[model samples]
Target: MTSRASRSGRWMERLNGEIEWHPSQAVTTMTDQAHSVASKLEQLLKAVANNPSLERQLKMATTASAICEVASSAGIELRPADVVKHYANRLLSASDEVSVQNFDLCSWDAGELLWAMKQWT
Candidate 1:
């Protein structure tokens, strides 16, 4: 039997793939929204990168609540899970072990974090 984590990972992969290939107008809208949310998340990550205090806060945060508090203090309006969902592909592509923990942001390496902030051109 597949573990819960394995099943969730598969579900996310399928959902993300469907978001790309499904040809319905509603799907298109959802894709656009996901991109927009990702862009905002990228901006937020960049902002964190440039601010030592914010970067420290994020790096030291061990719980989702702490991360959300830090993000809120930094003026990021989205919840951590929203950002994770929007940037799921980039994060997963960076590392196979990079799964979201308890619907919260997982710790990311500097390179993967920077990659997430890179704007789509």
Candidate 2:
């Protein structure tokens, strides 16, 4: 899992409070709007979980835009950037060192969101 760990190392470092934000770099904070989007994301995922057809559609979605379309059809407002920030907030809000270590790698991979969603099934 070296590649997985390496790919997610930035989140790991941020969890440990090791990252110092520079003005030029983008930082994701848990703003109210972001939280709202994250909640919408949760709503979309839950809808998919409860609907077999939706789950299948979501599983077949190959890109963030496709996923958003699926979510939109479910009446949930979500975006790719929202998905990215969702994981960032999750990593940033880790309650303990162990939880940080146990952070789900698949959840952090932007390209593997469909895979991650399936894993939750």
Candidate 3:
């Protein structure tokens, strides 16, 4: 009886040890996907800024799409025109108008805040 109990305990321990434990793979995958999307968005924004035609069309397309995604993530539903208006208003706020550095800085700060919030919460 003692040997039988000991053998059963060993088997149980082996079974438990063989089992793998991970909190949530889905959460990890989602975070990875979000990071990939953000990286691609930044790359696209840079591409748009480097060329006038790309900039115009991207402003009319990619920029609006990206803003929509951001707005959706932030629980806001905004039109492209509204975004453009807000952007124009920001442009007006600058005494010397706007520069590419300002554009990069804006997105960089936004991304920083976003990642920070994710980490904090």
C-alpha TM-score for every candidate: 0.45, 0.51, 0.36
Against the true structure, whose lDDT is highest? 2
Query: Which regions of candidate 3 fall more than 4 Å away from where they truly are?
Result: 1-23, 62-121
How many Å off is the CA of 28 in candidate 1? Answer: 2.1
Give model 2's TM-score versus the native structure.
0.51
Overall lDDT per candidate, in order of appearance? 0.70, 0.76, 0.61
| Model 2 ranges off by over 4 Å | 1-30, 95-104, 107-121
Decide which is better by lDDT, 2 or 3.
Answer: 2
- Candidate 2: minimum summed lDDT over ten consecutive residues — where? 21-30
Which 10 residues in a row give candidate 3 its minimum summed lDDT?
A: 69-78
Q: Model 3 RMSD to the real structure?
A: 13.0
Q: Tell me the tens digit of each residue's lDDT in model 1 across 30-117.
A: 7787777676657768888899998898888775567667768777666767655655656665645554552245445768667877
Order of the predicted models by lDDT, top scorer first: 2, 1, 3
